[model samples]
Target chain A: MATGNSEVVNNAKALSIEVDKMSKLRVIHYINQFYAGIGGEEKADIKPEIREGFVGPGMALNTAFKDEAEIVATVICGDSYFNENIDEVKAEIIEMIKPYNADIFVAGPAFNAGRYGVACGAMCKEVQEVLDMPAVTAMYEENPGADMYKKFVYTVATGNSAATMRKAVPALSQLVLKLAKNEVIGTPEEDGYLARGIRKNIFEEKIGAERAVEMLVKKLKGEAFVTEYPMPAFDKVVPGKAIKDLSKARIALVTSGGVVPKGNPDRIASSSAQNYGRYDISTVHDLTSETYETAHGGYDPVYCNADSDRVLPVDILREKEKAGEIGELYKYFYTTTGNGTSVKNSLAFAREFTKELIADGVDAVILTST
Target chain B: MVKGIEESGIPVVHICTVVPISLTVGANRIVPAIAIPHPLGDPNLSKAEEYKVRKRIVDKALHALTVEVTEQTVFEN
Candidate 1:
């Protein structure tokens, strides 16, 4: 549920293409629970169904790919398909869609639903393997599906909920059209999808060997060299509606930008941390002692703290609370090391923390990132 | 960081040294500062100037709490 960078290159550069040189290929759409027009939670086991034409985003896909490919059929299933019945469901869906001459397959702009994400990842993997066809899916960067299948398919960061379906569909559809037309996708950002371990042989603007030398020189000089392919914006994130009340509400301060204690007392790894623990400071307000520290390696240490105050600015937030600028600060602030944290863990932590916040009667939050 | 917090049904005010990145990344509310590393104040500055910088950004963060916009926004002093 974290906010995402909005600096995204949404539209691809209109590269030259011979429209007549491309052939119309068939494409298939896959959908889960909600989009299948099936009920949720109450209808978790409604079984699978295959239908011709668009469901949910299929109409949008049809519009985006109208000139490039035809979506022959739309396949719908409960997310439980791959999760509960992996082998049977995969085999059945493959057999079901086998009749269509699908050039590519598209599953969710999964947003951030955990079960739906896993289902999309599994189904895309199977379709790629069994049918030997290219497939595309989109998941939020924080979705576990991204880590599991990003290397296998073009996974875009979708908004965590289906509300982003319209925004998510266009990018995925455009990618499929380009794939069908054999159009060169310049980079992940330019192309609007995740890189699927497929590297294209492109001539460097400067000669190849010279490009390498230039990069080496920049590295040696410690210049802030931007990578050739900038990380694409996970702009598919839909900012949830803002909380309506703040001044009268209980607010908590939280951060994932790895603001921890000075000496790394928790022994949390500098990157790829698996465990997150919170210290209880009910007796004292600020995390000022030497016992607390940060484990994030992405930034310089001087500002984070010799004392933990710099990273976790609970002291300032508490001060504001005492002055009535905000409602009472929650007793304990939540924290996690954000460096290279997997999307799945972040989502899980958010869900868990939300529960705690609710139970504690906290109404709003002011999160800081360093 | 702000997205997750906001999704938890809370308002988050992001304070950053590099303001553009945060705003574009869809920060609903933002407070801009002098530089990326030391967002509040440059350690090289005198105490008075540093305090001024910190206070300005902090004030912007607070201001962000009361306004609304559909797109990402950063507050400048």
Candidate 2:
């Protein structure tokens, strides 16, 4: 009886251990040809291939994750191949990763290697977007791909070269664990990751006014003070190919000046608008005082209300169309109140409406803002 | 919003009173407005004068859209 009772106790302990092992988070690591033990740049054209278990820096990541997670597989591709055939390679790599059913995807601590950095960023982005999996990577701050993809992927900042691999691996692994376990991630300074440029609201012990006063005092004392909201580095777009001829162009009117029909029927907020309004002005040639007004609160409404065409010049655009200076006006106009609106919200609004503008074959836009 | 439209491969001319702000925001093509309160026209001017002012600004914006620029550019009225 005593022997039987001991056996039963041992079985229960074994079962608990098995349960714990099963719960270890599954991870898949991605690396370029060099790290995959393939030949150097010569092998960079090699196609993507998957291998079971850890490879290269992934071994360090495995150690960092320790018993909390296990790298189930490694997906290796050459930098040149990945970049040169981005769409195809991404699809193939995603397929390879899918079978693993990984909880997290980790790409290279790419360092300053531009091609490798791009590969890492691209893979991580694809995994996050397509597979709906948590993806993380490491790269130097100046890597061009870092600027392009950091907003979409969580990237840990590493030294300019692989000499920092020792440091990068642990930081990358820690972030992976936090994401896999759904743990709260701290600020970029605390988490050793690049800022994703996403603004999140958090409650504070003191009001904003008090914080501002404290910061002012510190500044007056010539002490260093950090701003709560750092200004964004705006993206500079190279101008698109110029319209060959204005007479043949179909121009569309868009505005952030908050000019809407007199009734403000869309109820777009006078400030910090959550959405944009699309109004059809196909039949209207001029914006008269009784027909249109300014919905914007930032600027005085008097002038714009007197002649809404001053804000959105449907009147002049019509004259241009009549004079054959331009092909025609697009039948509709898009308007939103830009004052105090978050960039994210603004982008979302544009993304949604631009599709329709594109589909309608609009050639150019005249975006007026106060 | 201007950036988004430009990024979609459509050329955009941002007409604003604040040229510096427009430049800082990375607008590729810009036309300066007369003032913040009345971007396209001076309200104090007579109706016909205001119409000419508005016409000139619109013409500049139209010209801006056609001119090929590789970088941020502000068109002089």
Candidate 3:
């Protein structure tokens, strides 16, 4: 009877081991034509295709994954073709990957290659959305595609050249396993991924006041200590060519001071505005107290409400037009409240209106903020 | 917002009370204002005097737009 019990226990252990081996996480690898060893730039327009198993870098990935995960299939597409026919190619790739039942999708450690980086980012993003599975790729920080897609996918940071492939594969494999296993992900700094600009709340042992005081002490002592919230880096723009002849320059007025027509016709938010208003002042000469008022909520708003021109300076700009100091006013002035507004939304507002300004032959803009 | 307009190839002069904040945000051309609450004119001044202050700032901004600059520059009021 003791011998029978021992035999049953041994059989149970053997069955569990077999199950573990059979249930290894399945990964589908994606690569561009170049990485597939099909050809370089010449074959950059090849249509999407699939191979049964690991290709090129996938070999390194598979070795890194070892017993934890396996590359079930490899999908390859040309850079130019994928980008040009993104919608069609994405659907096709999704269909191809569907049969593999992949737990995670991994794309190229594209490095600084522009088209290849874009292709990798696009593929990873699509796979995550369509398959409802975790997807990851790697690219250099400065790759334009990284900026565009990092928020949507987990992009591991890679060096500028493929020479870093040795370092990249292991990191990529580790991230893939973490995702497949449904483990908690570390910060971008810890996991070597690009900062996704996501704000996640976590409990800390120390209270907020203690953390603040500790940070202050460290700052006062000139010790290097990381802040809980870091300021975003602002983009520096090189100045455009100056308007040489002001008398021939068509000027326009733009404001973030929240100076809009009275009664707030567009109903732009007093704070954190999502939209900007474009009002025509072609016939109007000045911004009178009866006609306009302040919509901004950040400031006292008393003075601005008393005289709207103090914020927008339309009265002065109109004077300049009449005095021939400027060629003409663009007729339409763009205004929005900047109070508590996100930089992203502010950029979007300017982007859409600038096109109209260019189309209207505006040469210079005088932008006001409060 | 100033950066976006400047990046679109239009010369822009930012009028703000906080010159340092404007400078840090990379405004290529800047003209300082009197104060934050009333950037263009000082409420302490009489109506006509306030107009003069507003005109001076605007005049400086006009001059700034015409002056060629390779980097960020703040025009005097």
True contacts kept of each: 0.24, 0.68, 0.76
All candidates: DockQ: 0.10, 0.26, 0.28
The chain B TM-scores of all candidates, as shown, are 0.80, 0.95, 0.95
Cα lDDT tens digits for candidate 2, A1-370: 9999999999999998899779999999999999988867557668999999999888889999988999999999987577657789999999999988889999998886656777899899999999999999999886656776899999999987777889888788899999999999998999999999988898999999999999999999999999998898657876877888999998899998899999899998976688899999999999989999988864567888989988898988999999999998999999998665656777788878888989988899998886
Q: What share of the true interface contacts does candidate 1 keep?
A: 0.24
Query: Candidate 3 residues A1-370, lDDT tens each?
Result: 9999999999999999899767999999999988999986457668999998899999999999989999989999987577657789999999998988889999999886655777788888898888899999998876656766799999999886788999998888889999999999999989999999999999999999999999999999999899888787657888978988999999999998899899999999986689999999998877877888888764667778788888888788788889999889889999998755666788899999999988988999999987
Identify the candidate with maximal TM-score. 2
Best by DockQ: 3
Alpha carbon lDDT at A328, candidate 2:
88
Off by over 4 Å in 2: A1-20, A235-370, B1-67, B70-77
> In model 3, where do residues sit more than 4 Å from their true spots?
A1-21, A234-370, B1-77
- Taking all chains together, each candidate's TM-score versus the true structure is 0.46, 0.53, 0.52
**How many pairs collide in each candidate, listed in order?**
18, 0, 0
The DockQ score of candidate 2 comes to 0.26
- What is the C-alpha lDDT profile of model 1 across A1-370, one tens digit per residue? 1233332322222222334224567888888867776765345445677899778778887888766677889988876344556678888999999998788888887776555666788788899998998888888776656756788877876766677877887788888877766676667778777666566777657876787778889999998666665565564234434545556657676765466545555676665567565555555455554556566654455455543544455655666677787677787777776545665675677677777877888766655555
Better of 1 and 3 by TM-score: 3
Report the lDDT tens digits of candidate 2 across residue range B1-77: 77777788988899986564576556899998876556787878998998899999999999998899999889995
